[model samples]
Target: MSSRRTLIRGGHVLTIDPSIPDLPVGDVLIEGNVIQAVGPNLQVADAEVVDAKGMVVCPGFVDTHRHTWQTQLRTVASDYTLSDYGLNIRLGYSSFYEPQDAFLGNYAGALEALNAGVTTIVDHCHILNSPEHADEALRGLREAGGRAVWCYGLFPNPKHHPFRFDDFDPSWRLDDARRIRKGALASDDGPVYMGLAPAEVEKPAFEAVAEEVRFGREIGAKVISCHVAMGGHSVHVRPSVTTNLGRALLLGPDILLVHGNSLSRHELGMVRDHGAAISATPEIEVQMGMGRPILGAALRAGAKIGLGVDIVSNIGGDMFHPMRSALVEERGADNDVLFKNDQIPRRLEFRCRDVLRVATMGGAEAIGLDSKIGSLTPGKKADVICVRRTSFNTMGAWDPEATLVHYATPNDVDSVWVDGRAIKRNGALLGVQQPSIVEQVWASRERLERQYREINIDQLRSTKGYQRENYGN
Candidate 1:
């Protein structure tokens, strides 16, 4: 626990908790790592006071899914398709990532999230090429000092050329998972904790998926996340195999399904009834033609929804874009359904505040941390951010919620706190040597590119035609 006490005074606080009313001018008292009080005027002695005038105070954003290790390869897959992503990045580049490279990517990625007011993340670290890679990735998340679930990936890439890929045996995977649980994450409650990213049932042999998921639950992982029902590629284009795997194993609150682009409405209901959550990564899903963002479908099916950046390799690493994209995409979809019968939609089905919920509290619920860090409630962790409402892009904030959804960017973020500790202040991150981290990332990228110089960009692009023909428009 921190000995320092902090008081954030006089700001418009969006608690995100229904029990706590919105405060136009409020004071939040933070003692140690927990918020002690939130009201009009809370006085506490020996506290470092932070003046929050003219700022919009809110719970920090939570990213339910992100390929954080791909951060160093940012934008490298900008124009790549689903199949291209599988072949090139997942299978190709991920083969050469050293433990140091994983450290560079995850460390930088977590810091990027903090800088953007994303206080928590479900980092889908799929490149556990070796035991050392897992160690380095966990270290990176811990060193970055943010709340996260370091999801240990169990997916096998069988297509990486020049390297004979082998699938992780279930016994080996389960044993190592237990080892990490007992060793690195024995305490089970820290800013960074263990999660499982098992191979989805989409892969063949349904038993493998069940085995891994059972192992995750047995190990007491805080969450279990998986890529599901994402179809827009040529190789295997039928849709997720959750239906084939049968319903007996898919039910649970600890499961978080990513993408779900091709899930039928009934499948979504199954997820909802099972108390599972969906992480709808609108930017990547829409761009890669995986399917329309599934936020609308998930909501309609009564499933909890969370927003994610998915792959910084192909998109921006900020929550703003995903929130805005989800809002617009859902609205556009609603309009499409209404206009099909030559009738204009009477009203908007969703609002800016709704998307903001998906970005904040919804994410907390998705990862089972709703009681801890998703709101500005008195007992919640002090994971909060202050967005400058008077900034150039967000000036004249008529509706503060709309301003956050549509206008505010990362640049408008003024201060950020995770677990009552200030990580960013006055628009700059504290205690981080930015230049050294940047240098390390660049060096790692340079080495990978130099070694893998023979990868044919033209050949990779040519697969688009095959995808178009085989998978259709």
Candidate 2:
């Protein structure tokens, strides 16, 4: 038997690997699922050739955190704050989700990511209303044909019972998580790996949180993610989640903390020393009043940092928004200090390339897949994307990294490949009935909207206030 081969020819290639120099005009040869070679004018026989002229070929973006289950609720919470999201999407809209809704959302969301050149994601799905919901969500991810760490959410759905701030059972969720680990997600080498998204650290008891982390490790989960140090909650809650976890000696490299906007410098250092990473979703963090992004702090503390979309319900799924948002926010913060000191800034400290790295290599490192899919280095998996440099939005690109970070959009993505397979070619997704998926998602959205309006919004708001007072949500 012969191996399959694809030769992507003649493009400006940005291999994120530092050892490999960027190619002004280059070819990436893929044999089977791995990158066979990357250089100029690679000669190969009996291979399918893809013309990459007028394209910017690079490693596909890695989104370290996303609530992909909210695909059907796009723009439903565009004006929502962190509290509003909890009350409306989490408590209100989530009550009407059926198993098919979970499947459709994940499936459509993963496709949305692929369309935007995000080849891999850490799906922080917190919509597990039942074990069947878990199964369907995973099924949707698999069917979408993209790479992901489907972090099985342990957060209890409000639909299952009245929203509880403190008292809730994790025993059943843990059992189901075990079942998922041993069943479909037994192997880490698969396109989709198993991860754990435990309940929010502040809402749950310390002992229970520690137990969840231990159970994730015991089951050999690829990553254990948690929401920590977000917004006003961090200011009100004493002894940050990092401090608590560190005191108990539970912090490890596998832990990926999301939205640490209020994490102090000391806490950031602690995260670095303990080998954990942070995922910053800049747009949502800023818009939802989660405070300024922690990118600047995390960088100063030398913590591993990645960029994420967070939720499509309020923002777009593409990595462009987060990349640009992070870059500008950090630069603006630097300028503010200069202005405060009665001095004009001479140079920008945060570079466009830095945020681009956060979207690709940094994200892969955050999710612990840097060795496999972060770069276009030979021997790594072939997860790559080609953007149309000739497009009006991206024309006359001088610095490839800057062009990508500042100007590129999902529509400019010409092609995408994952595991050497062409998931998107000629600006269209492959092997999926996109129209049918969109129709189903729209139907789900309509049904959810009708059901949500029937719920007592005033009562939900009161409950939100109660939770805020008690659990510091």
Candidate 3:
């Protein structure tokens, strides 16, 4: 028996492990923060019993591409194009945000994510205009009590913002990186892991940006994330620039490239050969009118491909829709086959469960956390979520994999455990008062909107290169 274990019995266990096929009726023993054992009819006297009867016990979902701050400003700039949104909403809204707004927005955002069955999120926060705001934003995320990489990013600019590799030496973004790095290592309570996100390739001093990437190693920044191939934004440089820098700086594992839509074959191969990762956000990409999916190539290139909901402001932020859309879009893109021919019968490309792998294991791999999380194996972190199959939509659903991809929503999630801690229990939040967060978020949004009305940001954007010339988008 495990020393301090919790045994979950009497249900189907889909560990989502490709190595060991699914378990129809099995028992799982979670010892401390690690999954100690898995088998049938496991007996334990002291461990609390979880009656997972008629439920699916799988790994918690990971959203590797989300703008946590923008979630507070949902549907604000929907009328604008990608470029228009960036110049108006992204840059415009960011400039107006004080530290308090960031703190409140991130706090609200993290709660929303946890409630939606996402155990981990790449909080791609690019609104950090100063050191104080960065710390405030990070504090809110850490207090929210979910696994997140507080991805550091620069504030957006309408015109081309050349990053001098030299000037980044002591800027707020780099300082935030240094401070978060120190805090993570020095914190006695626990680590609040932070990652670097220069927003886009064109935002920073390229050389300094490269220096920051190198500095990540020195400062223990485990991950470096960038908005790659997100073609819809007004300020979005050609996807080629993103892939080029990624090739230059993202040398190996732990480098996360978000929105790999325009990634070419050679670039995909480079990413694979370098052992990098690709984060595909189907919901936001499809919503923003980015061309058909590029995940297939990234997946085939042997790079670690993960799933994310992307910008919550543009679309609903639940991980469920992204997973659902991925399943449907991938099938539609390939016609259920990579290349259909008169001779070959749809060569069985990208299955439903395979996409689930991207959301779970692929995400972990992308962020370099696979050993601790991502799977329900012995000696791994007990980051688990149980989806009740008896829910109205999923009643009597026997196929566990199919049920998850098709019917399961965040509300149907029975429980969510992060590092053996039940932050979400019985379909409700345990530690935080979610209602208060919700109220505050709404208040903040209303306040921001009122403030937006005060600032003529649309008039401001008119000064920059807000042209209609699409970059082959």
Q: Each candidate's root-mean-square deviation in Å?
A: 3.5, 1.9, 4.3
Best candidate, lDDT:
2
Best first by lDDT, ranked: 2, 1, 3
Q: Which run of 10 residues does model 2 get worst, by summed lDDT?
A: 159-168
Tens-digit lDDT track of model 2 for 132-235? 99999999999988999999888776642454544545468889999999999998896899999987767756787898899989988788889888878556
lDDT of 3 at 351: 77
| Per-prediction TM-score | 0.92, 0.96, 0.88
Model 1 quality (TM-score): 0.92
Error of 3 at 110 (Å): 1.6
lDDT of 3 by residue, 179-265 (tens): 767765344222246677764554534575577667666666667787666544423554465465655765668678778787778
lDDT of 2 at 157: 63
- Per-residue CA lDDT of model 1 for 1-473, tens digit only, reads 54788888898888888989988899888887888888987878899988988788999999999999998898789998776786678756887788999988999999999999999999998887777888899899888889998888876543334344333343455567677899998776678878999854455455667777787888888889978787644126343455543365655888888888888888888788888888999988987887898898788789987999999888878899999999999999999887898889888989998999889999999999988988888988889899988777988986779989999999899999999899999899999999999898889988877755666645544554323323443
In terms of TM-score, the best-performing candidate is 2
What RMSD does model 2 have? 1.9
Ranking by TM-score: 2, 1, 3
